[model samples]
Target chain A: MRSASIAECGHEESNAVKETQLLDIHDLVVHFLREEQVVKAVDGVDLRVKPGESVGLVGESGSGKTVLSRSIARLMANAVIDKMSGQVVFQNTDLLSLSERELERRRRKSFLSMVFQDPLGYLNPTKRVGRQVAEALPPELSRRSRRHRVAELFTQVGLPGDKASLRLYPHEFSGGMRQRVLIAMALASRPRLLIADEPTTALDVTVQVQVLNTLERLHREQDMALLVITHDLALVAELCDRVYVMYAGQIVESGDVETVLSSPHHPYTQGLIASMPGQRRRMNKVDGLVGSVPNLALLPSGCRFRSRCPHAFDRCEEMPPLMPTSTGSTSRCWLSEPEAEGEDPS
Target chain B: MSTRPDQSATAEGVSIAGAPPPLAAKEVSVVYRTRGDFGRRTARHALNRTSIEVNYGELVALVGESGSGKSTLSKVLLDLASPSAGEVAYHGKALNTLTRTEMRAYRNEVQVVFQDPAASLNPRQRIWKCLASVLELRGVRSQLELNEEITKLLTGVGLNPAESFARRFPHELSGGQQQRVAIARALAMKPRIVIADEPLSALDVSVQAQVLDLMIDHQKRTNAGYLLVTHDLNVVRAVADRVVVMYLGSVVEMGDAEQIFERPQHPYTRALLSSRLSIDASKRRIRDRPILTGDVPSTTAIPSGCAYHPRCPIAVERCSIDAPEPRVTGDGSSVACHLAE
Candidate 1:
């Protein structure tokens, strides 16, 4: 076990250029084995989260956004990994290649952590909040010191001083407080990258705003790399620096938040953005698109979105690679490609 | 059976008694019995003298978070759950004395589209069978006639090629499709009133919009009254013509949707609207809005005077001592706040 905390080592990785991409993933694939065949949950995904940036991985319920983030977090107990061939280069170390031990040793403590959706269920019910946070600290720390640090960690995450409140069981606290404790646990290691998977979904709207504001403050102060996985576009538009619209386990579009949200390049992205109630105010009710994501086990032959695509054509029969479109944004749509001879269905 | 609108007949038949105007509920309250390890108490005071009325062909939204009694009031209207106090009338008829057959007829007139489409639909049955089961119970004769009506209903809800969709099972379809099927099934009965309880809350954001639009469009075509129950203020803003704000089983505020949005008289209504994610960056700051203190009080232990006084930001001494009666605000909005007056 590594005795030293990365913060104590004074690693300069935190000082990496803000403009430079902190993590870049290309052609990332994650497959699950069923009885009959392999389910390609994340077939080919390209994702990039820059330093001091918050990016959103958005899709419907079964969309591969969760799987992709879990793969990076290395928390894929359910994933029957047929392959995860992709570059998840962070601080020049390929996360995919690192062994369990190397990954643990090189774990970007204080640099990478995750706050899951279910705050109450995430922490062990029987465990005290202080002890749960203490588990994230270095094992070398004595019981007394760990206890002291736990109180400080709780305070840092907006818990009250002395944390006599945290000394109570997990069930004792309210949902919002439990979520704050989860954030406290995530920050205990001082991770540079934070992968929050729908952290505020279960919370009330008032608490959701409170937690979101806290995240925004953390992202600004620590310059942390944040990848928010959520189904809410409104939340993404509010918080994320850039947005990646995922469909059928693959990123269909990725760009600046304003550009993508305002003028989406891909049809899927456009439908999703427009389908939101704020965007559709009785002019023409397209109801977004009419279909769900295709089954991963028996995915469509060509562009996965073609089945639901309003602009799908004959050319969509062949897979459309992620290409820089004429609209000055990246989109994996045959329609976006200028020279493509696909007939316009519209 | 007349297709044309008989305005006088419709008005006379649907209008509320005493008021001689439209349907009215005067102080409807519902209390449930609950027994815990400690002792016997109230399980939930689901509805607290929540007086609301939907005029003929008008869409009204009863909006509140869980335990606020939106669902309870919905049940009260359906007479599935009877109110402990106050009265619910249809036109001039009191509902509690209705025979089973009369209640069934009332149900045929008023239908509900639940929030969970999957749970509402029979998973074991095909989509057509689900619709067929209802039609069969209603005794609609002729297979060809029934089939035509089903297809028309499906098409009306934006499901093209109803035949193909009808053949599929509930699980085979998407969430949006399942909801469309549910809506079609509801319309198959040709109900005069539709009480949609959080219909779009379970759906994806984009899909929710589509469902809302469909519901709104159908209401326009049919001119049926809607009792929309939802926790989302945004949805109410988009679709509802009138808004009813419920708090701790009480109708805290009620008004035209625009009036409620522009000047929310009730503290609960104000908090809900303010808590909504505002696109305006300056208003997005959390502290600018007054956060409601404490969780909703247990229905059994509802406050002595005003149910909301415990959590109301501007609760006065009178607010805690005596419950404020609903009064028409100067702004033409009905508010049940002591401070509002």
Candidate 2:
């Protein structure tokens, strides 16, 4: 039914629904336990990414978007997490149920790969960048073939494939070049799904555009599903066909990028769209949402965003379930309730 | 307000008409000598002969990508870093010519807010101390008076129940709150000029609007000139009265915000404007946008002639041979592009 609804949204490629979902997350909740309190990082998020589809998870710093992505990639340490209950189904197999050895095997097979924000921190300072990428390549092949594969990956990511450039250390390359090398490393495995977390946030705008172009082209040619996790709505609008707006550790709204950005129902989503600076011609003052993200440890009852939401009212005191709105998208807000639609809740 | 010395009017009195701009960089150039490969010393021209000024009641946005020398230029204007070949004038008087007392007064008049609030603030001190020290330096001494002033400062920045926020350490607050505290510290001096370098870059998008609003609100109330050095054009479009576009250590374009946004002449400015990803989903896709290819060349090896000619879309033989001088167009916008009509 979800796939059918997505198909009805008039995506360019109808075949997206026919293919099995590359990744489907159900009721994912990740919480960290401190000395006494539990940090409710991700509280019940349901996300889906169809094969060859680019999905974006948009949220601010404390919105649990990063935690959700880390949980999806199974990068979280078991000891640190106090409560984690979710079904992370990847290509028909539940990733949560897999043993460490089995997961390692799957990771080696390149079923999933992730590129992080800080490229310099991820790359080895002493080792040549090309060798680092070559190491991520399958060890079964001879070193000569591995080097050839590394060069091919470099070319794919719009980086220089020459031997001289490959021999340089991480410090020698620019920030954008270093990020491309990391992307090349992630691409070395030829994974079906690529999870890029704030990939271009560290680089300059011009460099950022270059890196984004490379990612867009790679996504097109490789036919890989992309899950871009970022705070930038503009980036999501540019890259993803579908988007999920997360707020205070929960998905507030989910729909096609066009519908969600254009006619958002959730108050948090509305505030986010309005808060974006560059949308209007000449705005004297941006009507940014008041207050900050609620403290996860001591969250207020009912709607997580009520304190900051301008349109929040009595109905928001109770937690609103994620329900389908008239716009064919799901929104977790009382304003989108069928009977309450088209009326000013405030 | 009347008790404090009027530094702008008193300093030098060299102005023919009214007082000069609060802070101005007149053809300032900064070069750094660094150890290169094999222990060789190389001179990196971080800022070319760039000129910009912040008036008493306007926000001037200095925008550029990384390595464009926007940060270096901001430092030069703030008098944190001295220019190698040019002068930074504070109220019509050159900084070099200022007396000891005059220099101290200049420091009080011009306050700065850095990108990372956490780094700028003292982690060991409570929020109130961070603000109180600056106030005490300005001659607010009594404990009761200090508390009153700190409360007013904290409330002004939107931290409610200012007493609680003042007691907490910097680490206890979020990035946004810390930034607000940083803004409060800068405001404590009642500065005539504020130099904020990438103040919103470290903040979350939602929090950025609130902080920007606070800064603009304070600027209007105090009539303080602001030199906002940032890479985000959208923020520039929203708050800046005037815009200064920098590219490869040079001011590629300078004009009214509306003129720069609506009808940019420089190719670099055009590219920068177009390259910005719009939140409007109906806008053109990344593939369709005219994205400038290649990273900014290392400042150490800046290309000869027009620094932007190699990446510029419409470069001719003359552009590569001779650098184009800045020319004011009929619209009153200054552009340094050779092909700009």
Candidate 3:
């Protein structure tokens, strides 16, 4: 059923859906064992998603945003998992500590749900759209009951409810509709957390807006916490409340979305916002800073962004820990810290 | 026809291209015949009686969404795709009517830079080899001559020292650098007209700015006319001298860039600009929801009169039964709309 107008639903009721802490992650690290060395894809990142608050993980490609989000869902295979260490607390149990069989048993219900970038990749080509969503139903449901639930979900995500339409393959649906099918499947489980990584990136601008609106409305009605991963800062400005800016496998800045986007303290965050097309044009023709993300296998010595930072100094040679600024937001930059008195560069 | 009051008004609407020679396309149309889902052959008009002109050193923007036929027009102008009808005339010579030898001679005067740099280059070829091939095709033989031109071309596009980048391959370069190489390749021929097709869409937001600035500066320095094709209005506002707004393969509005932005007469143009989500957070909160009801219709099955009528928020009966002729609005914008008339 359609929820009441979003404005009518008081913030208290919206926040009161079991007041669940969906995923409590700390010191999450994913490393790959190369022939010569270990490369940390995700390093020392901590994240927490409450019941109904959606958090956006904003970063460019190769910023480790995708890898970190994927790892939480246990989508990465054991063979591909080189050396992972972290406490992934889910549903009152530390998921990282659970045995394979036990975690698999618990994963379907209370752990998490995910919508990947390529909707076709997540959806089976040969399988009927209804069957894909129905498979997420618990084994306790009989065949008829499962089919009935799938039809309800199809209508929930704004798809036609006709059984014949549901029987068609994934190719029959448009890109936006395929994404809706993926969302329907994710919501079928009614999991506490939903991780959508670049869900609307592939669609056109107007379609992207429509899909994002659907996602936001669903988050409110379902009371599901969301993790929206995307490279588009403009999208995050519209949808997200809090944001974490990642760079070189580290959280460079994290704060209220307005604070981070409007007046970002970190240099990388500033560059990212300034780099947006409609953001203030650069005073100089330098066009903000330009440098490729360093190869993950061969990271920089310290303060990974220092190589391209305009404010880099001698102190940046040492790795600056992720610390709070005067604004109370976390930023990992030497310049963000108030220097000791009488330590003058001039 | 010349003495009529309407003809005098139409003459008043034409803007002058301040230059030695005027570059223009006359009744340019591109039609493709394709089989329908049921195997019925149908004629698809990708571009419909479109005409565009750029002064000797003007930068004109062709703005349209996908299937609006902007790229098809670009390809036709670049001599890559032959139009079913009409002609592209530069300095009074029709491109379609030119002999093979004449076309080859004209190719050097009009070069195109494609959107994706990765797809534009031959992956196996070294950067130097690619640059050398352009010079070779133009009948330049000496190594010293090739080197001098290659260095100048690279440096012109902001690839400094030239030698460092000349030895690299397309894969070895970054996205911005690859685009620079593409620009360099286009400039190696010293073309008078540069047609860049959605050049920044594939790039990151910041890199897009840098590359667009580079192209703009190049245009200013070389005094070459630019025929830029893109769906982005923000880019058009920043770079275009005159903007031509297209909807469903027809020019719905055309005017000075700032004029169009300030007061768009066509509903399509108004909706396109207002639909974009502004980057400024305050503006995002303040602006009302866009009034665009649905997606652009497929080009294959265009509406009877105005292709945009079905989705037009303020469409009138005349817009559905009869196509509105291009008329000059009071604000100096040319619009094809019954309401505007």
Candidate 4:
């Protein structure tokens, strides 16, 4: 387990291992020009999601989680993404290599799909939900068959499956039901993988529970890989089998949710977990990280989190790799490096 | 209703019983009349016979789902919108019939910090300009006095080196900084009651903690009561002394924060506690707590009877026919569930 890393598992033992890769994002970099500054939103990130797997990307607002998700979906044409380098391999083909027309064709054929945070905006207000859900399906299907399929999808997502529901407008549905409608549309394409970005952030606790249950049920029944992007680590623990903790546009930690969350190795991850209120009986005064996320364009020379990290040392002047910890989680910190210091100051 | 600045009760609950509560909404009900898609008009019951009071130096959290009338109650407290049925009182005086001058004083006494600081702060105005506009009410004559007061306010909210932040526009500041400025503006009036409507929900996780600390510290420093309207239970647990849970515009449960969290009586309160997904080890074992099903009924067509009985797992047939009145429970909490006892 000492050499167990994403890079090692992806490259060194790739040929022998038969864990079907649904989507492999290697060295993904997303840079945007904001006010003449080239903000490196996502810098050299490597992530993988296999078939029937559920992975989470948890980060704060400026951590570039949204940008990374949009970058993978190739939906950032208008976002002014100056440079998007790296490979977004889906199933067998590199999505970055495909032309606009080819990408559109592939996307239409339903290799993958996405559900955004705002269902009110994603759903058409004037049109009936049944038509919108049916419209997401390939046009080759007969109109009657599409309606039947939409109803089935609606049932799968736990919406009322009656014909009356098909006639309802987007404005008539509740926020949670509208989100379920969007999910129904996302599943209409029958994609092999689904990316939901902050799907429940706008909802209440009870509604969030309903939506999460829907996503979990979908992941279990359909077997489509789930990539959930959110700032809520608690939601991540509930839905994801594995998780990636992102900070300042970098994957600081990644591992199974059961092990990584219970004992997060990275300082940033530890601070994030502690900051959550109501998790403990007493409000642990050991308040979370001291400072906010660093500016992307003006990032520090060493680790981006060094400025806010509590246990910084001289060795932290150099960036640490995402190495495996003894706890089976890959952490991007010098403290987690077993051979770095003999005394184990941490 | 006993935890005021001067008066104290049994010490077990935050009952503001004898304290002519600094800010309170008594039997407040707001029904907005809007024309529907057809020729017919409809009524939306945003708040229905809801009463919430905040003592001079207390932190009362109004916790509920989206359409649970939390925002409407905040508005009633802030005097932003007048309730149709009942009255809001401040300092033992009914607010609905107050004179213009008295209302102006009330406005200054009760300030608000909104959810989106960016939207609340004027984008075209600099931080100093925004702060100065609020200070003008105090009649600060000299430029030096104005500058000194503005800087002091900024520093009070933890934005140090205030001169630099003063010159910057709202867009130039970060979300957390903008929120700090908003809090500073609310604090500038030397407000007695600050109605913070989901102040930390827009902030990032780390920044959320810092902002929460600032708000709590502000409450401690000024003895200014806070009516915190938020859905985040974590925020409630961290700072709120009393917790009020609303369901479809009605107060289903209200009690001390510890009693509400540890031993929730109402089925809705219990469901809300279980629905929370925290970073605690106990969260995983919450599978036994039944997750209430069904969407929250719309405010326009609030359910009859218990309002929660449609989704309440323990609801009996009697629940749907008769509305349950709030009653005192053993935990020193007031629960509206007929089966709570």
What does the interface RMSD come to for each candidate?
3.2, 1.0, 3.3, 2.2
Model 2 segments more than 4 A misplaced = A1-19, A344-346, B1-19
Across residues B76-179, which tens digit of lDDT does each residue of candidate 3 receive?
A: 77777777778776554566556566566667777888999999999999999999999898787899999989998888877876998999889988888899
lDDT per residue, candidate 1, A1-346, as tens digits? 0123334444565533322556778688898877768778888788887667789888987788888888887778645676667777775567888888888786635367889999987889998888888898878889888888888878776677476776788877778779988998898787778899999888766667667877877777777778999998777777876888888888899887767777677899888876766434434344677666677888989889888888877878999888886556688887776565244556
DockQ of each: 0.41, 0.74, 0.27, 0.50
Q: Pick the candidate with the highest TM-score.
A: 2
DockQ of 4: 0.50
Off by over 4 Å in 1: A1-19, A104-110, A161-164, A280-287, A325-328, A334-346, B1-25, B35-42, B278-313, B316-318
Better of 1 and 2 by lDDT: 2
lDDT of each: 0.77, 0.88, 0.77, 0.85
Cα displacement (angstroms), candidate 2, residue A133, comes to 1.9
lDDT of 4 by residue, B62-157 (tens): 999988999989988887888899888765567866667767778888899999999999889999999998899978768999999999999888
lDDT for B257 (candidate 1): 87
TM-score of 2: 0.93
Q: Lowest lDDT 10-mer window, candidate 2 chain B?
A: B1-10
lDDT tens digits by residue: candidate 2, A59-149: 9988999989999878999998999998998877889889999889888876688999999999999999999999898889997898889
Tell me the alpha-carbon RMSD of every candidate: 5.0, 3.6, 5.9, 4.3
**In every candidate, how many clashes are there?**
12, 0, 0, 6
